[model samples]
Target: MDVGLLFDLRNPAQWHRPWADHYARTLELCEEADQRGAGGLWFTEHHLFEDGYLPQPLTFAAAVAARTRRARIGTSVVLPALHNPVDLAEQAALVDLVSGGRLELGLGAGYRLPEYQLFGADFQRRFAGTERNIREILRLWEEKAVTPLPIQDPPPVWGGFYGPRGARIAGRLGIGLLHISHAMFGHYREGLAEGGHDPRSARVSDLLPIILAEDPEAAWHRVAPHLAHQVNSYRQGSVEGTGRSTPLLTAEDLRDPNAQDTRGLLDILTPEDAAVRIRELTKDLPVRHLIFWASIAGMPDDLVTENIRLVTEKLPPLLR
Candidate 1:
């Protein structure tokens, strides 16, 4: 399995620190991770979130490309429904050129209603729009000629799918597939079968919340608030056609707040509990690439580095 790191660029606490410091630390992490043999560094895109979520992932990717020589740079997802397809294609092509063809584009139909409203896009037809945009982007990158042409062949494309229809579309288009953490092994396998393709032939990846720490209590204390943020955001509301939005996960929502829970779960795991959860999650799944979204609300930079070190050092041995 190819191990990758995912950054959401969230500014959880209004900690009194220079923005440049954060960016510098992130670059430090990227360089260190590359030296440690990480396969890639993935970024996320979000708009109008006061939480310091990145609004321009391509720009960030360009910066990353300039700083790091070996690690692949990618967006965990760019919301296709919110972008003009041609412009996005041009930007993506430019980033690919800048990175010497090391670009993995992850496209999504979008899910947050507020984001759609902010973009003035109709939430109902987002999937259709996303599909159309993907087709247009492919054409623009592969067929259409531009003023400054791309340096290499078109960048590899990965379509993020939450349901069967999107998966089928990806299969038809011969694009890579990105599955979520929940029950995606079964869904991805079934989708490949339905598309009349061997599961082994499909290029697939998955993203999940992961942390590796020696002390369970310390890790949970650092990560729980951020976890709560994600769960709350999804539960507040979810767009239709987005598969299985997170249920309400407030502190009150926990049946046993003190209990360390892992029953009936597929991908999520506590750091000290289930070391083999990663293997189990990917066992029957056709995931050659695995990206871990690695941040908890108030996790310190040192702890984050340690978490990355543990995954990079410990997980690869297990896989071998």
Candidate 2:
């Protein structure tokens, strides 16, 4: 499995830093990971976020391309229905060129209603819209719609469909799925067959948010608050037309053990244990790349750097 890192580039109000400092620190970390032989550096997208969640991942990805010589720069999921497909094609081609052809584009129909509404996208037809966007993107690359074309003829496109029906749609599109769970596994294979593509052609990847640290308890203490903030931020949706930015939860809120939002995703493991859990997660699937959060909601620079080191060095050996 190719191990990678995922970043949302969120700088929350409580832990805010100058935007330039935040970006610089994150890029430096990416360079460190790349030098250590990380398989990829992936970014996530969201618009109008209160914590200033990354609005344009492709833009950030272009920066990563310039800083890293090895890691594959990609977006975990870009909501293409919100923009013109040709524009996306050009932007992706530019990044691919800058990165020397290391770009994996993952497209998804985002769930937040306001994002779709704000972009004037047809929310109801989002599922179909995503597929159409994928088709147009592929066609544009295939037809050389841009000058000189992308370095890779049709860089791999992935569908970030975490639902049963959507999994089949990804399969029918003959692309990859950002699937880390088994819930939609069978459906994707069936869809691939239905699309007259071999089921073996199905590629899978995902982001599992956990930390690998020497002292699990201490690491958990530091990351729990950030993790809670990350999860609870998604829950406190706005009634008005603005994006979610309020009612941020502290680590204390998540300590209840019954704090509905935790969903048991918080864990800080010894690298040894993480290797076993990861093995179990992928044993039954054809997992091409396995991703983990680089840092959860910007925990701490020193700690985040260490986690990246452990992941790129210690963790890979254990897996081997």
Candidate 3:
């Protein structure tokens, strides 16, 4: 179980300080995590969310690569539906070279309707566009003399899948798989098998919210509102396009639930009681890596460091 860190570039009220301070602290956290023997850093991409989220993952990843010495840098999921494949390929390749080949590219279809509208992209064709863009990106990386030649070897790419079709595509393409939270867990293994991929040979990773504290009660107070807001954001976003109501969950829902709510399923552990639940939720899964989104709701740098130390120092030895 390799461990990694996830940064959402949250624009929370608590972090209303200057952007430079947040950026500097983020770099420090990455370096600290690297020194503590963490595996990687995963950054997310979003647009038009005044909530202080980043819209450009490749640019952010490039900065991370320049600052960190050993930890691999990755995009949790870049929306290929909204990007030009050629430019993405070039930028990703340049970052790969800068990092000495330590890049993990996770590509995904655009999901948020606002982002689609803002970018002037047709939301309906997102899946198809994502598939085509990924194919072109692979071609640009694997083939030589692609009009504008890249600077280094092709970086390893991963398909970010939230459904069965995307999972199948990942296996067929022979790229890695990134499962966000727990939405696809039940069908992921079968999807890989259906695509004629051996489960053991598949490189599957997941990103989840995490926090570690000496006092569970105190941690809950700090992280609960943020976790609730995150869940609400997904639910609100899902309702506009899908015409479905997002279901809420109780504590009992985590253990056993009759309804299959995607948000409920994915928010597997609420921050109010995450430490113990996270340990249990990860067991028995083919988790190649566990990436912690520690900057949720703009947590303080010290808290982020404590969470990373908890995973890298305290958790792994027990798992072994």
Candidate 4:
């Protein structure tokens, strides 16, 4: 149960701050998370969103690296089809250097149609393209002529997938899996085994949204609107594989906290509630990292700070 804070850096219109202010506050949160003993700080990537969802995660990651000393910095999943793999490799290497080798790379075949259209990339071929990109990036890293190599021997590689093919590709490449649902754990590990890798050695990290308050209901109320914005925006963008929106969540559900099934997608909990959930989730899976969204769509800075404080004070010991 290595715990971390996930930064999306969204600036929603309803509660928009100036772009500069938003970025400054985001940096503040990262420094705070690092100082408070967070194990890692993960970032999400999106492009051309009304909310200004983070488009250049690695760039921001570099800034975060410069500001924080302890926590590992990573992209939850950087889209490979959007950029030339060779260039991405160089950018990633620089960030790793800036972070003192504390970078974890999670590459994925993205699922948004508009993004693909804007980049003139074939949506249908993104998975194959992503695989090729990963191989090319690694190959570049190994070439003797490549200069300013990453500080880590090679920062650990992770693959983001919504299905088995992605899992198989990652396993075959000896990369870790970034899975969102418990249902995919077995498929991921099995893929690793099939790829001639030991399942026990393959890392699996789950990403989710989290909010904390002593009164769970109160927390839900405070977080609902922002959470809805987070989910609905992604829903509109449309996920590439297996569909983007959670089948269990509807537009109405996003607006009504009670209507959403908080179990799988959202982790709005009290410390006691998180203890139970973490225990159940880790009981059977090799869940190494539990990364969550801390600063999100218009979530008040005070509330975000309080959630970080509460989780830091209470959650880690239970995992031990």
Top candidate, metric lDDT: 2
Worst lDDT window (10 residues) for model 4? 240-249
- Candidate 2: misplaced stretches above 4 Å? 238-261
- TM-score winner between 2 and 4, please give it: 2
lDDT tens digits by residue: candidate 1, 1-320: 57788877777554424667777777778778878877788887777655667778888888887777777777879988898888888888888788787788888886777788788898889888887888788887677655354665667777788687777666656677887444544555565676676766677786765666777566665566566665554445454235555455654343254635522222234443444776676665556678876555445776688778766666666666
- lDDT string for model 2 (1-320, tens) is 78899989999988999999999988998999999999999998888788899999999999999999988888898998898999999999988999999999989988777888888998789988988988899898888876757888888888898899889988998999888777788999999999888998978998886788889888888888788887777766433355435566777776668867554566688889999999988878888787888988879887788889988998999989
TM-score of 2: 0.93
Give, for candidate 3, the lowest lDDT window spanning 10 residues: 262-271
Range of the 10 consecutive residues with the lowest summed lDDT in candidate 1: 262-271
lDDT of 1 at 177: 80
Estimate, for each residue in 93-145, the C-alpha lDDT of model 4 and write its tens digit: 99999999999898998878888777888888998889888988888887833
Number of the top TM-score candidate: 2
Taking all chains together, the TM-score of candidate 1 against the true structure is 0.83
Evaluate all candidate structures by whole-model CA lDDT and list the values in order: 0.70, 0.86, 0.71, 0.80
Model 3 deviation from the true structure expressed as Cα RMSD, one decimal place = 4.3
State the displacement of the C-alpha of residue 111, model 1, in Å, after optimal TM-score superposition. Answer: 0.6
Task: Write one digit per residue (lDDT tens) for candidate 3, span 134-239.
Answer: 8888887677535444444567778888687787777666667787435555455565676676766666787864556656556655655566556556566656
Number of clashes recorded per candidate: 0, 0, 0, 1
Off by over 4 Å in 1: 14-16, 147-152, 180-200, 237-275
Off by over 4 Å in 3: 146-153, 180-200, 239-286
lDDT of 4 at 6: 83
